[model samples]
Structure formats: structure tokens, C-alpha cells
Target: MKKYVMAGAISSILSYQACVLAQENQSKSDFSKQSYFLDGFSRNNLDQEKVALSTHASRLVVQLATDYQQGMAIDWADYLFSEKLDGIRAIWTGDRLITRQGTPISAPSWFTDDLPDYAVEGELWAGRNRFEHVMSVVMDDKPDDMEWGSIRYMLFDLPNQPHDFVTRFDALVRFVDQTAAEHIQYVAHFPALSESHVQSLLTKVDQNGGEGLMLRKMTGGYDLGRSDNVLKLKLAIDAEALVIGHVEGKGKHEGRMGSIVVKTDDGKVFKIGTGFTDKQRGTPPEIGSLVTYRYNGYTKNGIPKFARYVRIDKSKQ
Candidate 1:
């Protein structure tokens, strides 16, 4: 009888421990699923590290645009073209501004005091061709008050709204008008242009140091991630690649870094030697870091032509 009692006690203890372990594992699994679902991402598609790092604290995710090809057939009349501002993409969550990557912006209180309680998606712009300046101002943990004064929250879209593009644009315009805030302004969307007219506009914008153009389908709804309804038209094709190795410099650049060997997401390997400043060559993008590069187009053998290093994607880290 004594032996049977002891055995029963041991079995109960083991069962309790097993139950606790199962509960812990289920809790972890639930947390992971919640994180991915909130961020509008799929756990199956992303790696473990990315899934762990994903955050949707802002409760908002902006829609992304696809690249536009020259002479691509589309209904021009159904789209609204706007100047692609060379600045950081920021999402205004009514109370505060957050980067597209979910990092919070530390703008001065006065900057957001006039914004509405609803969310607005736009870019933190510092005029045309002032990307670096805008980045310098907003990237700081504590933004500089005077520097932020020059920055503008260029309103573009209203995410999560049920209205079509035209209705949303009008609503955004009215909201900004009512606020009467200097730092907040609507991004002017131009009417559709002919193919020749688009080329002319691109030339003019390029000459003025603009980045490119964004075409928003007037009939489409705002959707998360890259959408076919929206397109980015740029002269040079730009893409992000992982830096795998570096080559030694020669001649004038001897003793310093030369070029970086990179592999695209599609497994295309290439080396970018140009577009690096002296400082960049000294401290090149570390191996395993993602870097953006610009190229004219792809060669017949699937190689990027005139590949030039653009910038390191610091957000990936």
C-alpha cells in the first residue's frame, strides 16, 4: 500500500510538470502568431529572426508601391501622378510619427500638436533633394527643434479608409486645410500625362534633383505591402542586395576598400565598384548587411548594368 501511494504521488508530479511545459510552449506559439498577424506578415514566408523582430505597435502599416517600367501599358487616365519626394517615409499615428519600419520619430511636440486624432501616411520631407538633411533631423533619438522646423510632413494617403483613391485624396486635402498647419501639407497629385509628356516631366524633375514619380491608381483601395495599383517611376532601377564580400582597391584607391560583392534576393551575384565616397570605402557595408544599388537595366545574362552603390539599408538591422 505504501509503495502504491508513493508511485501515485510521483505520477501526479510528472503530469503537472508536463502540463506546465505545454502551456509555456502554447503561449510562445500564440505570441509569435500574434506578432506576424498584426504586422500583416506571414510567419511561413519570413525567417525566424525577422519574425522575432517584427513589431506592429503603431497598429498601422502603409501600403507599398511597385516599380514602373518605361512604356508599360496602363490606363493613364485612371492614375494620379505625384513627385516622389527624396525623404524618409513616415506614418503619422495621430499622436506620433513612426517610420515605415515601425521605429518612432522623436519630433518636437509642437510639430504634431495640430494633427488630427486619426492616422495619416506621408513622408518627412525637407524640400526637394534634401533626403540626407531630413534623415539627419529625424534619425536622432531626440530630434533637434530648429532642424525639425524645416521638415514637412508631406501628407499622401489615408490608410484603412474604405473610400476609393479620389475620395480619400479629397478628404486628406480637407483635413489638412482645416488644420491650417504650416508643417503639414498635401502632396499635389497631377492629372494623367501622355507618354511623351511623362518623359518631359521626368526630365524636368530629374534636372531639378527630384527622385522620380509615383502613380497612384485612382480606383484602387489602400492595401498593405507592394501593390500593383501603385507604381514608382524612376530613371535608374534600384534594388537591395546582401553584401557578401569585398575586393581590394587599386591605384588611387590602393590600401583602401575597393568594391563590394553583393547577391540579390533572386540569387544574382554582382560587384559594385562605383558611387562610394572615400569614407564609405574606408567603412564599407559590413558583410551580411543589405545595400541598395542603382542600375540602368539587366543584361541578357541577368546581370545589372552600371551597378552603383546607393546606401546601406540600416532599417534591416
Candidate 2:
């Protein structure tokens, strides 16, 4: 039995290695034949242009989080929870700041002059419920100096560092304190004790107009993409759907607009009418565009319950 088990394990390892090599070879072949042009510009040329506009911002990528579900398999004691700042994700590559997609933010030199010469990852926050304002400032080709003044770099993790999260967090706090850079600050985190505590914190944050909570595993290393090490906890979940059509307005909504017909990622169709402002109704998300909607949970039929329009998914454009 022992001999058989050993042979099976070795066979499985060899099979996995063969599969990986096959995938890598296929990827290289595809890349060689792939058209360089996408969206009117050569892919290579676009990448080169992005590199030219950025200074040492090409290599950095921020870590992402997965949504937290009830009864998820995570050790709560090993997690630290913090307020999920609804701001633009930025990576400070020691010298300059860049978005997760490697687009260089046109921040003034003074904004980063006092920052340390170490790679840091965090959000470019404006304040509570100021996501639109923050986006307007950072997404511009030429950042407005006055608007940038209100922005803060809320550092959360130090990428590629050898230290664990707690140690890295402490180092970040000390570094920020020594630099005395008002805009460069660390995000405050607390121990996640129990489910009740998590719920209480979520309620408090929501009541204060905050977005949600982020839970990070204390012992996990800084990972590049979405990982189980970090989780996003929210009271109401939001998801993107493709707008297919529109349901005409009625009563108070007459003469303006009505609910939007959308198809969810899983192919479930629904109409979302509530949570739209008058201006948004006047200029509803166009048919065939993508939009985000908020929901408490899914119904028995697998449809999103209490679905309401959140915002147009500008990222899709």
C-alpha cells in the first residue's frame, strides 16, 4: 500500500508539471501570433506609452480582496479588520504613485517628496463617501493641485517585505510618523474577534456613511492578486450586470425614465428602478452598457433580491 501511494503521488506531480509546461508553451505561441493592435493602438505601443508616462510605476500592483460570505472558512482570531475606504487604489513605487492598471497618476512632485523609498500599497482617499471627488482628482490627465490637497494616501501594506502583516503595519505607522507627511498615513485596523463584533463594526461604519470593512489575515504575506488572505465584508453586496433594455416609466417617473432591464453575470434577468437620482433618470445607463446594482441577498429563484441601481460601470467603457 505504501509503495502504491508513493507511485501515485509521483505520477500526479509529473502530470501537473506536464500540464504547466503545455500551458506555458501555448501562451507563448498565442502571444507571438496575437495582433499588436487593440482598440486602435498597437498593444506594444500602448505599453511603451504607459511606461514612458510613468516613472518606476510599471512593476507595482496592488493586492485585491474577495468578498466575505457567512460561515466562510477563515480563522477570525488571525484576522484584523479595517474600514474599507472607497477610494482609488494606488501603489506608491517609492518615487511616484500609479493606479493598479499601471496608469501613472499626475500628482505633483510635492505630494510624494516626503514619502519613504519603499514600495507601499494603499488607497488614495479623499474622505468618507467622497469616492466621486477622489476619482475626479486622480483620474485626470493633469491632477488639480487644489483637489489633490484633499487627497490622502492611506497606506495598508508594504509589498515584497519579509515581515508579517502586524510587523509591517507597525513599521508603516512609525515611518509615517517620522516623515510627518500629512497626506501619507496608515489605515487603522483592529482585531476581528467574533461574528457579532464584525456585524457591530459594519453597522457603525455604514451608519457613519463609510463604505464597508476589510479583513486581513495577520500571518499572511502580501499577495498580488485576489487572495484568501484578505476579505471584503459588506452589508449589501453590489455586482455588475449588462443593461439589455429599459422598462418605461410610470406615475411619478413618467416623462422621465423607468426601471432598467439588466442581465446578471449568471444570465438572470431583472429590472432595477429604485436608488436612482432625478438626474440619473434623465440620463439613464444606456442600453447595452454595464451597470452596478446593490442587493441584500439572492431570492429562492437565484435572482438578486431588493436590487436597486447603484451606478454605471464606467470601467466597462
Candidate 3:
């Protein structure tokens, strides 16, 4: 099946926030009890040694506007723009394919029967608006024949090329066109000659239930860590994460007010304390399951500064 990639930014705030609430009241002793998604995969050819990603990765976050004002700004429009589909992110590296959190998707042999031996990144989606159910099957690795039948592996970028976003995206579109497979369809990248064009697309995507759009630099090199060049914009929502440590509290809650520690799938730790209600603190999330939190900014020490609990993420981990 041919697959096309849509362009837009992915934000970590929601993901990060979820991790925070997940870790609340949990102690380091519980880390071993957790089933980290990465633990289930085969290590053989797993690219154990991490490579520095390109300077400008495909993770750019796209900014949106309510109304387009001509002659505003453009960040190298070479990147393609597409509706950010809500699906599980997967990275297929030759032998094995895994989710962003490193869970092994038990896709039926038939599901991946047409895949080539290439390093591809895309979403493991079942059907439109079935995100929660789709994630449940893929993350479980249970090899459900009936479940796999409804799924599609929507690939967007090939990792081996070592090209910038623009170059890789162009190649992705061409490859999908050539394959002409029904199961695979290219993620559309709409071109906007003016700001109004961008506004129209954003409105269309949001109304259609998409997360948002990603903006990428065509000529920029891919970077291993997060890059500012790629930004994400979206409506406010809470998320969950793992708690790592605590901070000193202030004011009435001062003695107990420090912040809470949280970690992302990427292993970046931050703090949360500003968004939770008093009731949430009484029954914080367990050490393992996902939880939600909120806050902004990082400290000079590279940790989250202010954050508070929101709720538990009942979604499958």
C-alpha cells in the first residue's frame, strides 16, 4: 500500500503533562513494576546505539491563526502541510516496528505483508475516529486477526535517506504515488500561497477532528532532540506522565508545595503543580498508570518548574 505524509507540528505538552500525574505519589521503587512499552521488543537490529537525529526533525509544531493577515511570516514553506491524524506513532526500522513509547505492535503478517525493508515513520491507525480502540489493539501485541483487518500503516518519512524534512517529504509523496496501493493513501499536504490559505486549512482540519498541523523547514538538517523550528499548536487538553521527584511548596501549601517530577517517553523529566485541584492531590495517580498535569517553562537545571495534577489518563498505556 502506498502512504503519503501530512505535515504539521506535534506538541509534547499534553504527553508530558500526562506523565506528571502518572508519577504522582509514586516512588522510585515502583519503576520496575511498570511495563514500559520499550521492554517488549526484540533487541536484535534495534539500533541500540542512539544516533544524533537531524538538526530539524519532523517534530515541528505549526502555529495557526484565526484570520489570515497577508505579508505576515513564512518558515520555509518547502515543508508539506497535512491534517495531523490522531493515531499511534510507529517507527519501522527494517526488522521490527514499534510505537513512540516502544511497544511492539502485533500486526498480522498480512497487515505488513507489503512493507519493504526500509526505516519508515508513520501512524498505526485503524479507522477514522477509532483512535482509542485502534491503540488498544496495536499496543496490546495480542495478534488479533480480526482487529488487524481494519488497520492501515500510514507511512510518511523514510529514515535512511538522511535528507532534510522537505527532501524526505518530497520523496515520500512520490513513492506513494508510484505504488498506488488502496490500503495506503498519501497524507495530503496543502500548499498555502497566502496566510488566508493556511487559516482555511486549519479551520477545516480542526472541524474535521484532527489534532492540528506541523510546520517543517525544507532545508534544515534533522536534529536528535527537540528543535524550536518544529512547533505544535492545539486546543487545551490534559495528559499524563511518570512522576520522578518533588519540589518545595510555597504559600499555604508551601511546606508541601514544591513541584512534582515527571518523565516523557523520550526520558526528559519535568515538574507539574499548577493545574491540579485540591481533590486531585488527595488521590493522586498510581506510580505506573498514566496521569494528567499542566504547566509551562523549564528550569535552568533542565527540569519542569511549575506543574499541577489534572486527572488520570484512562487510555491504554
Candidate 4:
């Protein structure tokens, strides 16, 4: 039996040290700030070892296109699938559990006191319908006792195994089956090898008020950045970026007119002024939307380029 060091039980009241630590890492602005600054193709290779166990934004899963059923994609035909989670995305570096964004998750000692020495990626879920509640519960360093009991830390990926994702996932399933912990369970990964299959799943998820599916490759190493091996198949056109600056208006767009400059994690910036109606422009997106701007990919940077505004993403708010 592998025994990992578990942090002492968390109290309902957070300690002064925890408060100070949270404040230090807290961002000044969630709107204009680059919240999801990591979901993209890396210009340079990121050092995975440099990433801390607690940072949620450090790791990325490879996205395998549904079209790619052969070659490396089939390496895990028996490995992946879709499952609804009413929790937050998390990763375990064997010893500690951290949110996808790198924040330390104050998981209850009882939840992960006996987890194996492997890095697993999944969600700290509460229920299929308690999505936001679970999200809120997991984000707090001082987790609520009542909420904690309602949540389950589901494990999906095993990082310590040197085998490909297929092999690693096999080990993960076995570990989950062998342990058979009460709340802990493994998420089944399904294969959507066609556009219709992917779209059908998306529709089903959306209709059921569920998020989209995660497409992962079977043959790739866990490299950072937006790799084709790991793609998020969602119905919405969402992207998070930094508000570099605001674009000036032209013609009737003078003064209170114009678009806003936004940059993705890969340093791709563009002016997005279209998509907005008069009411939207009047109040603008508060200089930042952290939004999902829709466009035709009219430019070289894979952005809408001279794109228009879309609705502000309140979920990210």
C-alpha cells in the first residue's frame, strides 16, 4: 500500500497564512487579466517539470480530432470516453491535488489520504447537476465541510506511468477498480471518430446542461500548449485572453467608438469590434470580456482578425 502525506484536516475557518497566500496570488482583475493564458499552441516547448503540482494552468491534455481514428489515435481505442462531472478540473501529483489553474485545492484529508504516487487528471466533482456549486466549492482553499462531503475527486489520468496515454489510462482504470474507494471513481473515455458523433455528443451534453467532451491522443507525450492530440469539443466558440489595450474608433465610431485589443496565451493579439450591437458598444465589454469572439478566421494569427464583439462570458466572471 502506498501512503502519501496528506495535509492536516482543513478547518471551516481559513488560517491567516492561507488568507495571506490567497491574496498574494489573487489577480487584480479577472475581466481584463489573462485568466486562461495557457490554452494554446506554445511557441516554445514548456518545461513540464518546472510546473508545480498545484498550478491548474500548467498542464494540458492532447486533443485528438475525431477524424483521426487510425495511427496514434487508435492507440487508446479502449481508453477514453465522456462522463458528466459536477466538480472542478484537477490534477494530482501523487502527493498533492491542485486545480487546473495551479491553485492548491484544500481537499479533505479523507478524500485523497491514500491515493497512489501518480499524476492523475480529472475533476473534483460534486454532482452531475451541481456544476457551479462544485466549481465554487473546489476553488476555495478552505473547503466547506458540507460541500466537501458532497464532492468526489475523480481520477482520469495517471502521470507517473511512462507508457503512452493508452497504457497510462489502463493503469488508472485498474487502480480505480482495485481501490474501489467509496467516492473515488474513474471517468470512462469514449471515442467519437466522426464529426456527427462529436456533434451529437456536444448536443447531448449541451441539452443535458453538460460541458463538451475532451479529445485526447493515445500516442503522444504530455507536452504543453495546444496540441492537436488534445482538443476540447465544445459547442460554444469560447477563448480566454488578455486585454492588451483598446482600439480606437473610426468615422462615426470616433471617440466612444472602436474595438478592444486582446491577446491569447500564445501572444496572439487582435482587434475585436464587430459582434456588438449598439447597447453592447454603449457600455462596451468593460474594456475586457474574457469572451468568445466569433469570426471567420480572416487573418493569419488564427483569430477573427478584424472581428466583431460577442457576448461577455459571464461563466468566466
Candidate 5:
């Protein structure tokens, strides 16, 4: 049951042109109908608010990853890297799928009917640069069959397992195959051959519009909350902040949000104004929720320079 990560070397496997084509193929269409997957019987006639709050969340028991630090001491042989999928986190609790906040996500019967009884955690992804679309379809109280069909469940772990990462990943592979679910696949991992290998993978994913890479210790057992065993690597510095207030727009944005004031984990407060679209600006993250933002570095005053809004955390609210 215990083995290692990827057997092959992390080379130029992901084609750049194909990545461009894939990005080009990503939909900018209205959250209109498209794609496949999921089951939708119990939620056949439920309102979005009712379905979204299917469960009350007190804590996020799922294991979380820390931001990767450059030049960190890591024994290459003991760690593995997987593409940090830019999709919402989903926990399949035997019979249904829920967000990290324990909010229910209605899927069609076909989507969950064949999944194993044990809990599995993964990203509900559509593809690169399609985070918004994935959010639209997944957050809906009602299941969008066509859209769900094309969306995928890229599993990274089997929670509550008694084994290390390797065995857990091995178990995940078997579960994926045994179910024969087309929309379900394991997030492939490869050894951290060296810093170069990590950079290569990071570059490829970035070029293809991906966020970054996730590094996990091969020998570590899954632990809830942030752990050094898991880390995130990205080009720009990314972090989550607690929303404290909203700044209204003055001109064209006069009617909607101009920016949001957020407090970082360390208590640094700032406003994220750039990187939001018109649609998103109109509906900013609510107060008391969490939001992920990107920044370059800190200024002399200890503020994140050029902070940009990324995505709002839906788990808290």
C-alpha cells in the first residue's frame, strides 16, 4: 500500500501551444448551459439559499496548505509536487459533496451515485482560467446537468485514512479507476526532483493560466489546518484576508464596490482595488467573509504593494 509519487521525470510534457488553445477554449459565455456530471433529485425544487446552507459549519476539518517559501529546506526525495488546481475545494462526504464550509453542493444522481462511501477531498474543476464558471455552476442550489457533465473532480487525497500520503494517493488512484467516473481523476504528482523541476512545472502551469504548484511531503499523514508538510508555490505572493469593510466607487463604479478593506492574518489592513471585473465589482465579498488576493512584495510601510483581488472565500459565509 506504500509507494512513492510520479515514476517519471517532470519534463516538458505540457505543450505550451496546446495550453494556449485550451485557454482559448475556456468559456467567457454567460453561466449558460454547457458540459456534464452530477445528480439532482433531492434538490429538484430547492431555493439557492436553502440548498447553499444545507449544513452548518463550525470548523474546517480539512487539511490546508501553507504558502511556499523560496529557499525553504526541503529534501527533494521526501516531497512531491502537483499542479495547484484553480478550482473550489470540495469534500465528498460519502453521499454528497460540500464546500469547505460544509455547505451542500447539489449534484445530479449520476455524479454521486458511483462514488465510494468513504470521504474524499478534491477540487471541483472545469479547466484552466474557468474558475468563475466553476463557481457559478457549483454554487447553484440546483444542479446544472450540462455544465456539470464537463466539470471534473480532481481528487488530491482521501481524508481520514490511516496511511501516509503515498498510500492515501495510491488508494485515491484505485478509487478513481474502480468507479470509472469520467469526471473524476486523481491530481497527478511527481517527485520534487530539484528546484529546477519545481520551477519548470510552475512555469508551465503559469503559462497555461494556472495559479501555481502544491508541494506535499510524501511521508506525512494528513492533518487538519495549515501544516508545513503542505505548501503552495506561485509567481505572485497570495494570501487570504478577512473583509472588514467595503469602499464604494466614485465614478463609473459609483454604484458598486470600489475596493474592500481587509485584515490579514498578521493584522495588516489594506484595500484591494485592481484585478476585479465589472461583474465581480458589482458583488464584492461580504463583510466578515474571507478573500484571497495577490501582491508582489511589501512596501517600506509593511503594506502589500499593488494588491489585487483574486477570489472571495465562500466557505466562511
Candidate 6:
């Protein structure tokens, strides 16, 4: 039997460290549960590595996107737009795949065996608008073969490649073909036709139940932190906040949770009363769970206007 060596985890919790060292082994010395923790194409390649396991997975840094302005004065032609996937951010560090927070995902051997021996950044997507389902499958400590079989590693970027975005993506395509892994795919990128074209594309995606479009500057290298070079445009912007408190519902919603009081990273606090299903209202996100929410622009008081609950990250669940 092949064994995955999980070492050097920095988590303060002893159980978490034990889980990491155990490599999801629960019974029969096999991976059982995994805790987990994409793109579009066109201008060049939908195109997109593997290496030894690194205890340093927690240190992985990824380039993040900034909100796109409606009429920003940048050359649209320089950008490659693709769908903004609502999948978990995962980095394949040669030998092992780890989540954004550096925890090993309990994936089956056949699922990851054919992956390259270098670094590739992408999403573990189940399908369109299935974020909640994806979370349930990917976060469980025990690995579910059937559910994992339905997931795909949708590649979008080559983090360590010295080349620019276009070249890196082209290389990623070749890399994916080399592995011939059925679950691995490349996201296609499209060139900008015009402002109206961009808006039309955005609307088309939104209408189809997709979240939004990501604009990547073809000439830009993969740089970490928020940058204008990579922008996100969605119908209603989504962000993450920590659950602080819950308010009791009144009127028709009386007795259950009326709303969840959440605090953003910037220290702003607000209540989200909408977007919860009956089941969700009965079991509102627990205090301290980081939750994702959608909202329009902020109000005069600097609050996220019309803020509504989305799903919480699997780790928090």
C-alpha cells in the first residue's frame, strides 16, 4: 500500500495535527474523510504540476481578484475573461493537493495519481451553482469515491511558471493532456470584444446560473494579493464575514433566526436577514463561522446594502 507522509503541520489543535499526520486514515489504513478546504478561456488557452508533499502547504499564496468597475479605463482587449468558478481554491504542490488554508483533501488515489509533478492552481468543481453540494462532499473527513468521481479539477493558472498569463495557460493545456486525467480540465478564456460585449457576456453568464466573469490581463504575470490586473464582475458581489450573533425572527419568521449579525474583516458589523431557507433559518450559522454573503454596493453608513447569506466555507461547517 502507498502511504502519504503528512508532516510539519502548524495547527495548534492536537487533533488537527493528528489528522494531518494520519493522511485521512480512519480504517483499514485507507483514506476515509478529507477536509478540504476555475476559469474560462478564449484569448489564448483554457490551458493551464506536481511535486513532493510539502508541510509548507499552509504557506501557499494565490493571486486574488479585485472588484471590476463598471466603466474602468483599462484596455479590455488586454484581458481574457472566463467564468468565476464557485469552487474551493486548491493548490497542487507536486506530490499532494492542499486547500487554501493548507489542509490535505482526502481524495482517492485514482483521483490524484495522474496529476503532474509540479504546482497547479485551480478549483475542485462539481458543477455550476453547486457550491453547497461541493462543500459537503469535499469537506468530509471520510472520502466518498462516488461523489469525488463527479468532481473535476478545473485548472486556471500556473503559479510558478515564469511565463506570462497567455504562455502559462498554453503550457497548462499541454500539461493536462500529458496526464490524460478525465477529472482534470482547463477553463477557456475569451477576448474582450467591447464594453457592451463584456456586459452582454456577464449577463449571459448570470442568466445561465453562473456567478460571474473574471478578467485577467493577458500580459500580467501571476502576482499575489488583490490587483486590478485580475478583476471580478458579478451581478451581486459576494464577500466573506465572520458570524457574530443571531437575531430572533418576528412576524411570519417568529421563533427561528431572524437574521445573523456578521462582522466583516474591516470591523464593520451588520445583520443579514434574507437568503436563508427554512432549514437554514432553523440552524443559522454558528457564532465565529466565517460565512459568505452577497450584496450590492455599500450604503452611506458603509454597510453592505441588501446583504444576504450565502454558504459557509466547509472548514467552518
Per-candidate local distance difference test: 0.70, 0.69, 0.50, 0.54, 0.72, 0.72
> What ranges in model 4 sit over 4 Å off?
1-79, 83-87, 242-317
TM-score of structure candidate 2: 0.75
Using lDDT as the measure, the top candidate is 5
Q: Rank the candidates by lDDT, best first.
A: 5, 6, 1, 2, 4, 3
lDDT of 3: 0.50
Q: What is the per-residue lDDT of model 5 for residues 120-229, given as tens digits with 9 covering 90 to 100? A: 88999888878878888888888879989878888888776656676666666656655656777767665576777677767877876888888888788887778887
TM-score of each predicted structure versus truth: 0.78, 0.75, 0.55, 0.55, 0.78, 0.80
lDDT of 2 by residue, 203-274 (tens): 766776777888888778776667888899999998999999888798999987798999977899998999
Which of the numbered candidates is closest to the native, going by highest TM-score?
A: 6
Report how far off residue 110 is in candidate 5 (Å): 1.1
For model 2, what is the alpha-carbon lDDT of residue 208? Answer: 66
Write one digit per residue (lDDT tens) for candidate 4, span 11-116: 3432323322122123223111211111222313322342233223454332223423223333333223354443566777767876655557787787787676
Q: Runs in model 1 with CA error above 4 Å? A: 1-60
3 or 5, which is superior by lDDT? 5
**Model 2, CA-based lDDT:** 0.69
lDDT of 6 by residue, 203-262 (tens): 767776778888888778877666787899898989899999999999989989999999
TM-score comparison, 4 vs 5, better candidate: 5
* Superposition TM-score, candidate 5 onto the true structure: 0.78
* Each candidate structure's count of clashing pairs: 0, 1, 49, 24, 14, 22
214 Cα displacement, candidate 2 (Å): 1.2
- In terms of lDDT, model 1 sits at 0.70
Off by over 4 Å in 6: 1-57
Candidate 1 C-alpha lDDT tens digits along 1-317: 11101111222112222211122123222222211001222223311121111246644446889998777889886776677877888877656778888878888999999876666788888777566688778888887889999888878887766656666666666566667567787676654546566666666666766777788887889877789778998888778999999999999999888999999999999899999999999999999999989999889999999999988876545
Question: Candidate 5's error at 75, in angstroms?
Answer: 0.3
